[model samples]
Target: MKYLMEFEPIIKKSSSLSPHTFSGLAGVCEYLAEPRSKEELAALFKTCHTNKIPFRILGNGCNLLVRSAVVPGVVVKLTNPAFCGFENLGNTVRMGAGASIFSAISFCSQNNMAGFETLIGIPGTIGGALLSNTSDKSGPISRFVRKIEVIDSLGIIQIRDKEEISFSDKGNDLRDPVILSVEFAFEIDKTESIVKRLRKAWISRKIQLPLGVPYAGKIFKNPRGLTAASLMEQGGFQKTKVGGAEICDRDSNYIVIHPNAVVEDVLRLIEQVKQGIRERFNVDLELEITIW
Candidate 1:
């Protein structure tokens, strides 16, 4: 009860919009604390930690879908603070975990940073992406990260300078740690050429991913040799609907949502598709969305 009060004012002004996952659709968080400065972040973390308050660090909320059940914890959102910006240093660039992936790409492009352009289609903050190892053939989180700075549950800060500081295959994004920033390596290139490529990449991403609807990106990972989307299509799961969730007709890969769609709909559809794919293809599809 007391913690609720401390988290109240902050919740009233947090961002709206939640994604879908195994759980049902949920309300916007009770509170959202957007700490822009390191001091603010420290204070927020210190206060919540000291009081034993429940909280989750959030990036853009693009990859998450909290259930409709009242969320009992506080959400910490990193805003457009200077602390989240990037700076060029030698062959690498330091990126604030709070910065949006889109912004990071732009920053890199303006500064002639390459490699990260392949992540142009990914939607989420750098922190979320890093935590999730957001990438594909371009390599997940390992290709660019030179070092990760994180704050542990005990509020102790640590820096891992080498690869293998991961939590899963392609390793962890230091998920358990509250990431502050990461240093990435990039090459020098023509600004005009970089921007041109970036623009093309963005357009391509739009075509590949269903961008017009409320989605948490792809819901499943392909089993080894096959693509999840292809499996769903082969299983005839396209345009399928449960509640507010519907297999996007525009693309077999997406779960299109209506304004009234609840969390259950998406969850149901995903499960159905998964079961169907497994039964038909004999391959279990792994879910990509993190559900809580």
Candidate 2:
């Protein structure tokens, strides 16, 4: 419903490709995905199985950089309306995994929910955040998760409580469960203070991330006791470029997508950057963005 008014314009702006980055993304996904309830999701998966058709799940694509190469199967952008719902539960919030983290932070601030101020400018969905275990190793998104609802590959919906979910000290999730929704426990504080903190986070993000570019935020994850951005700068990989992909001079933490940059070009640059860093510092860089 709302997607018709909001995402269709974006769909039109982005041209379709044969085998794009996502296994099921861009033209193929945009044309086929129709968000529904759990039952509908199951039915859709059933249809895919019965027809011997292929399909895959995709979220906001914020953490994704799809290749120009395409995936043959049907693309599933989990836009299930139910997956976008946000509910207040005492000191917690139950949200659809599809709900944008940025939006969630704003809502929490408006409602005076604290503990999420640090996430104010982060652009991702609840599910993506959890899978990435977004954090600086002190804690992860799974740390705040009280429960997770997910649809397995079998198309069955299940919920995992906090105790059922566990994380590595390095901030990685052991489970490969496909998250459907999540219940986030939060601290309560004064609305004004939280809002102020949010503003501060936003300002910080604006300075660090290249907001106007088409690039995905972070290209590589920070290694133990080291920052990815810092490493890149040390080796002077900041000025490197592949096709139209370039390391943002303003912030080595981000890669800026020049006008008409293809997916392969971005991937090439990422590899080059990784190699450069390793050659100079002897550290293997881990990629942060999920290549679809």
Candidate 3:
């Protein structure tokens, strides 16, 4: 605990994590550190590693579902400009891990670069997207990734090529504790064409997703050839509700929260849907969101 004092300017003890996540329903964390630079991040990581303290990297928290129980760990948020910068190259763009997916897409569109339009409506930072292999029907973000810079659990920096990484529907194989930056290769296209594609993607997502709702993310991943939303509808979970959490009428795979919703409400609803689907269709649903 005394080590935290060394970085007092960046450390907040027993901080509420609700505002950091999209769900806005989390409890407090033992320590929330917002390191301003890579050096500070490395030092903080080293301190946590040496002290055997649990360390977690938080991005935009778009797909995170933290419980109401106090989370015991050092939650590192890369919000400083030093960790959220963007560099434009000729055909490739290097973006800091902390940069939002929307920011990256905007930069690409401005530079007349194509490919990122597929992720138009997706939230979260580039680091989280890469770690989760965030994608839709078009393709995964991994397809454009050329290299990644990361900080391992021991606070050592390393650069990994695309060949060294493997991505699946579950996520990526990179076990690094922190992603520092990502280099992406894109095609040169007209700015109008790129914007048009982005618009189309955004509209498509808006129609399918439960936007403008208090939700962490999609509750479950599509089970192979079958979509989770259709299955939930078929299982008659559209009208299901627990406390202030209910299955979104627009999309059954999402559990939207009301103003008074608690984490337990969402948890119970998830369990109910999982159990119902298992009993009716004999299919085990896997969660797409990360629960902390």
Candidate number of the best TM-score: 3
Q: What are the lDDT figures for the candidates, one per model?
A: 0.70, 0.67, 0.87
Candidate 1: tens digits of C-alpha lDDT, residues 117-215 = 767867778888877677755467666778887776767667778564754432364544478888888778888877777678788778766565566
Q: Considering TM-score, where higher is better, how would the candidates rank from best to worst?
A: 3, 1, 2
Per-residue CA lDDT of model 3 for 1-292, tens digit only, reads 8877889999999999988998888999999999999889999999988988888999988889997477887999999998898998776789999999999988888888889987887889999999888888788889899999999877988889999998877678899889999999998999889878888988988997757777757678888889899999988888588998988877887778889889898998999889989999999999988898
Runs in model 2 deviating more than 4 A are: 1-31, 46-53, 136-139, 168-171, 174-177
- TM value for model 2: 0.83
The window of 10 residues in a row where model 1 has the poorest summed lDDT is 15-24
The TM-scores of all predictions, comma-separated, are 0.84, 0.83, 0.95
Query: How well does candidate 1 match the true structure in TM-score terms?
Result: 0.84
lDDT of 2 by residue, 234-267 (tens): 8888868888778888778677777766667677
Q: CA lDDT of 22 in candidate 3?
A: 86
**Better candidate number, 2 or 3, judged by lDDT:** 3
Stretches of candidate 3 off by over 4 Å are none
- lDDT for model 2, on a 0 to 1 scale? 0.67
Name the weakest run of 10 consecutive residues (lDDT summed) in model 2.
6-15
Stretches of model 1 off by over 4 angstroms after superposition: 1-25, 39-43, 46-52, 80-83, 167-175, 249-251
The Cα RMSD in angstroms, rounded to one decimal, for candidate 2 relative to the true structure is: 5.6
